[model samples]
Target: MKTLTLLMTMSLLLAFVWERVDMVRLGYRIERLKSDKVRLERERDELRVKVSSLTSPARIAKVATEKLGMVPPRQDQVVVVRLEPEAPSPTSLAEFEIKLAKHDVSRKVR
Candidate 1:
């Protein structure tokens, strides 16, 4: 009976120790993930700033003029394109309503 009790006590102690070790391991993992998330977020913000600078109109214009040797268009060199307004749709609501009214009136007359 004494040996059995000792065995039970040892088993319970080992279980407790194992659980504590697992908890510590999980805590370290959580810390590592948090740091990684922060680092990635910082990198994303830096990349966003870089993209904005690279795509800015002023930067683009400067690069075009300096690297590509592009020149601004003179007044006569520029061409303006005008888009004509589209005609109203054939099946407009007003036309549909007029047709519907005429059909109703003719039916009533009949």
Candidate 2:
């Protein structure tokens, strides 16, 4: 009976040791994940700053003038065309399709 009791005690001790080891491993994993999250958050902040700088109007205008040789249009160079609405509303699908087909043909000719 003593031998059986000793065996049970040893089994319990082994199970307790295994549980402690697993707990320590999980703790290490959680720490590593926390550090990774912090690093990713820092990287995200850096990227946000970079995007803000790159998208600023001053930076865009500088790059356009220096790299692309772009110039702003002068008042005399701008021309505006006023569009007139001439098409009557279609009452049926067939009428719409016919009008769409005519528009497509006219566009293709141009």
Candidate 3:
């Protein structure tokens, strides 16, 4: 009976020690993850600032003029095409087919 009691005690002690070791390992992992999170957040903020600077209109315009050698179009050089609304044609399937055939024939002639 004494031997059995000693064995049980030793087993409990070993289990307690193992639990403590596991807890310590988990604590270290948590600390490392926290530090990684902070570093990543800082990097994200830096990238956001970089993106804002890169996307600014002034920067875009400077790059366009300096690197791409592009110029704004003059008003006189722009031509606007105005489209007039066409009258509604066939509503039935047969009528639509006939209209399409006629349009195809006209296009072939042109």
Candidate 4:
């Protein structure tokens, strides 16, 4: 009976050691995952900075003028337009005013 108890005690000790080893392995994996996460986050931050730089105003203007062949409007080619308030009775005068306003806004945006 004593030998049997000794063997049982030995088994329990071995089981405890095994559990400790598994816990240590899992801890290592967790640490590795944390390291990977940090690396990925850093890379993402770098990419975001790069994207912002590429989309900057100067870069966009350069691309627009050089790549797309866009140019500023000439003064003679430009016309002023205004928007007239809506009236219950629409008149050609009011419609003309509205058209002018829309053209003005469009020119300003460009």
Off by over 4 Å in 4: 73-110
Q: What would the per-residue lDDT of candidate 4 be over residues 1-110, giving only the tens digit for each residue?
A: 99999999999999999999999999999999999999999999999999999999999999888887666656655666766667646444644531211133354323
Q: Encode model 2's per-residue lDDT on 14-82: one tens digit a residue.
A: 999999999999999999999999999999999999999999999999998888766675555555554
Look at candidate 1 and give me any clashing residue pairs.
none
Among these predictions, the greatest TM-score belongs to 3
Q: What are the clashing pairs of model 3?
A: none
* Residue 88 of model 2, lDDT score: 50
lDDT of 3 by residue, 52-90 (tens): 999999999998888876556555545555443366546
Ten-residue segment with the worst summed lDDT in candidate 1? 96-105
TM-score winner between candidates 2 and 3: 3
Candidate 1 is scored at a TM of: 0.66
Q: Pairs clashing in candidate 4? A: 81-100, 81-101, 82-100, 82-101, 83-101
- Locate the minimum summed-lDDT window of 10 residues in model 2: 96-105
Q: Which stretches of candidate 1 lie over 4 Å from their true place?
A: 84-110
- Residue pairs whose backbone atoms clash in candidate 2: none
Backbone clash count, each prediction separately: 0, 0, 0, 5
TM-score of 4: 0.62
TM-score of each: 0.66, 0.68, 0.70, 0.62
**lDDT of every predicted structure (CA atoms):** 0.75, 0.75, 0.75, 0.79
RMSD of each: 18.8, 10.2, 12.3, 8.8
